[model samples]
Target: MKTRNQKGLESKYWLLIIVAACILCMAATFFAGVKSGPVRVIADYTVVPMQKGINVIGTWVNGVADNFVTLKSVQKENKTLKEQNANLKMENNQLQQKAVELERFYDLYKMDQNTSDYPKVGARVIANDGSNWFTSFTIDKGSADGIREDMNVLSGNGLVGIVTKVNAHSSTVRSIIDEVNISSMIMTTFDQCIVSGDLKLINNGVVKFEQLANNENEVAVGEQIVTSNISSKYLQGLLIGYVSEVNVDSNNLTRSGYIIPAVDFKKLQEVLVITTTKQDLIDNGNQTQSDSSEK
Candidate 1:
């Protein structure tokens, strides 16, 4: 039996001997004029196939490298497109927000023009109870900005509420639809009545009014109801709502009905605070009356 090192050495010697034989054969064919024999057959069968295999492997390697480059480029382009799409979505959202803000401002402008006769201040509603409606909410303005308790708050072409609580920089308004508020109002026909704010009635999109002086009165549905001239806290003639349904009570002593509020409490956002209280109007009226009598 041969050792491992002796076997490896014999294998190396045999490989060298084969290489030397092939070289000698090529030399004989080229320079010694030995053509068209076993040497020619050896080159055709062995050397030609070896060269072809090397060329095929080189081509395959080049093709794989090119495919890898193309794949990387496609991935880069896809990533760039994703980034562009995200940025476009962000821009579209910003534009939509701006448009909504612009429309709100335009509506505020219209409200301001409608009540231009009074000394008023514009205020934004900032906070509210976690309900779906603005039943009672806080405004951004307060006593520091001349906001006072009982100051009338208006929105969307009609009266919304009155400031009930005031802080240094914020105030809470109690909407006319708030359950605690009982508004004194007058109809276009000069009939006086009391408006009640009920939670159940608000869900039906109207407030309750009862104690109509005349059940036989010609006040019909769709009659416009405004703040009465006699209301102490709420200024007179500010639109409250329109009459929706009228019915006689069981006692038949009075008539009760519903008024669809002019201001949509659910969509209430901004308001115009008539800075002057109802007391101010009364004072000015009395002062004028006194002056006229003296004259």
Candidate 2:
């Protein structure tokens, strides 16, 4: 009986301790709830560090959003610049082509203006043989176009030279300024002269003119000279050059002068070939005479 009574007493004491602990837990929870209106407390810690962490996280997210927006804007700008660059390149190419076409048209106009008298066939110079003493150039037209040897070759400005050789599709022209070319001439005043191409004289941009006939009037400076009617090679009245200086031989009637050629040989580009046959010349002359008689 005594033992049973002792056990009952111990059980009752344990139940009371549990009840006390439950009450203390409820009191603590009530106090914590009341203080959580503006400041929360768990055990002995406050919520300040958690609030700071939330603020830092929000700022980082906003920064990431701004960076993404900047990157997209840069990509858009890059695409636009690329398109503009391509357009500019296309425009530049078109302008260059236009410039080339204009230059070709100018050359054609010049060629037309220079060959108004003769029925001319225009040809472009394809090659130049400047290394040889007998300097020559090859043209794009030949015998099929009625281009023959010894025919006159004139440039857009004035007389260039004469055709020296002809092929089926091309011809070579030997310029009057070539070392082998010699032309007989007469001064506008009163003297007959012969002009020869000396390489040294051409180096100085002049030709040597030697007077042939005896005359009282010496060849004067600044006198114009033309191809003589007696010349077997060239047509009459074609301008050779003006006399720059006249040097008379001692105890001789003959004199020599320097000739500045009418044509600028350095810039020669396009040339016209006069292919009218010699028989045509005779026919034309006879026709003119008949017409005159009728009149």
Candidate 3:
């Protein structure tokens, strides 16, 4: 039953005694040295083991800290390398696309040099309405670029379609593979025929041609077909396709056949618009209605 002040004094006195004992032990160790005697034996059994344990703990902690620093550096380097790889892949893709575009331009150049020599505006296919066929699609050029409705659109190889709709900045081309699209084509011998689109035939990459003159016209499987002089809408002599199959109808009056189109409808990426329309030629007195009359 001691008072609060009495208990506090007892605690202080015990703390001083412990401190004095600790100082005496430290001074004894300093004077006695650790190389020999009972003092050394006491150090080995007590302070030496404690110091060894502390050194072991410090070594482990330092190793852990160093490992964390190395891990952080490795993660940062990996992130930087991944970003560089992605950027390089993007650059390679861009270069490949540019090369493809350049090749297409060269093809168009050759076509322009060999054919009608008419003025043309080159346009890229911006969008396609059909998935498996080029029945209809939009171009990047339009009226503002001198493109007009019914203007004959040609690819690198031959006829692609005609511009059907035009806006200020873009135009829609109705491809020859469209159901309603038709072309008057003539064989090498001036034998006239009608080339029309059929969804069934186009699925096979060919189109229907009929009314081939039955005079034993001798149309072969590989004969070339071109836009006829009788086509009022299309420019004459534009390559249509090559005759693929030929057979006289049951009536034995006219031959019906199919032609593989000169232009690959499924791969239409760019086209050339012949700015000189058939109507334009007729207006300029370069063509006659008699020549463009439907056969």
Candidate 4:
């Protein structure tokens, strides 16, 4: 009983000492806090870094979202531009085709106006015989279009050729440059001569005029050559060519020269046909009637 009492008293004393120490430590902590003036809680360092981080995250997310929206808008604009370009190309092609058709119609209208009196027919040149001796071209119009042999063919400028043969759908034109054709002429001077076709020297688009009246004096260059009034086939005063060169014999009895043809045979495209039988008479009558009316 006495030992038990002593142990209990010792245990009570240690418990009291531990309680007192804990109380003293708590008091010291309180005193230190007071001395430090409530610890002056400074949020400047920690709170500022957290706020900056939030701002950076928000800015990054906003930038990404804006970029995505801008990209989508650009793609849509590109697609629209592509479609507009395609539409413009289609419109341009249509306009080009219309312009071509209008040009063809204008050509046809002009041709019609030119051949009002004559029973004329417009024909397109289909093929050319690649020979200087023959010098013929095929036209699209033939017997079906009232085309016949010996019909005079004229281009927009002047006479082109004569129809020699006709097929069902096409006709052949014998150009004036052929060797078989002859163009008679009276000199612009006081001399009379005949211009004959020679295919040998026709490479330079000229012909030889033989049996000139005044062969003693050489013919001057640049003199105009026209179809003679006595020509059985061709009309008078039709411009044949220009005098380029003159060759005279030693005895001065006969002379020949080069004549550059008026028409460029290589570029022949559209032509007119003189189908009227009394075309010359009709032309003269009209001129006379006009003169009478004017008077």
Per-residue C-alpha lDDT of model 1 across residues 1-295, encoded as one tens digit per residue: 4698899999999999999998875664464333577866776666667667889999999999999999999999999999999999999999998998788778778877877888889899998987988999999998889999989999856888888999999999999888754545556577888888887888989998988865456777889888887787887788888899988878878788989988888987888899999898899999999999999
Overlapping backbone residue pairs in candidate 2 total: 0
Runs off by more than 4 Å, candidate 3: 1-33, 126-133, 140-144, 165-170, 180-192, 212-224, 242-248, 251-255, 264-269, 282-295
**Residues 95-194, model 4: lDDT tens digits:** 9989965665565566457556556778888889975444799999988888888777766544566788999899999988776555556456535567
Question: Model 2, 133-225: lDDT tens per residue?
Answer: 335889999989988877777764446678889999999998887765455665555456787866677778788888556576656666777
What's the CA RMSD for each of the models?
4.9, 12.5, 5.4, 15.7
For TM-score, candidate 3 versus 4, the one ahead is 3
| Candidate 3 lowest-lDDT run of ten | 286-295
What does candidate 3's lDDT look like per residue over 133-228, in tens digits? 888999999888998888999999898888889999999998887875455655668888889888788888789889887885578888988888
TM-score of 4: 0.52
* Candidate whose TM-score is highest: 1
Ranking by TM-score: 1, 3, 2, 4
Model 1, runs deviating above 4 Å: 1-63, 180-190, 213-223, 250-254
Q: lDDT of all predictions, in order shown?
A: 0.84, 0.72, 0.85, 0.70
lDDT of 2 at 94: 100
| Colliding pairs, model 3 | none
- Model 2: which residue pairs collide? none
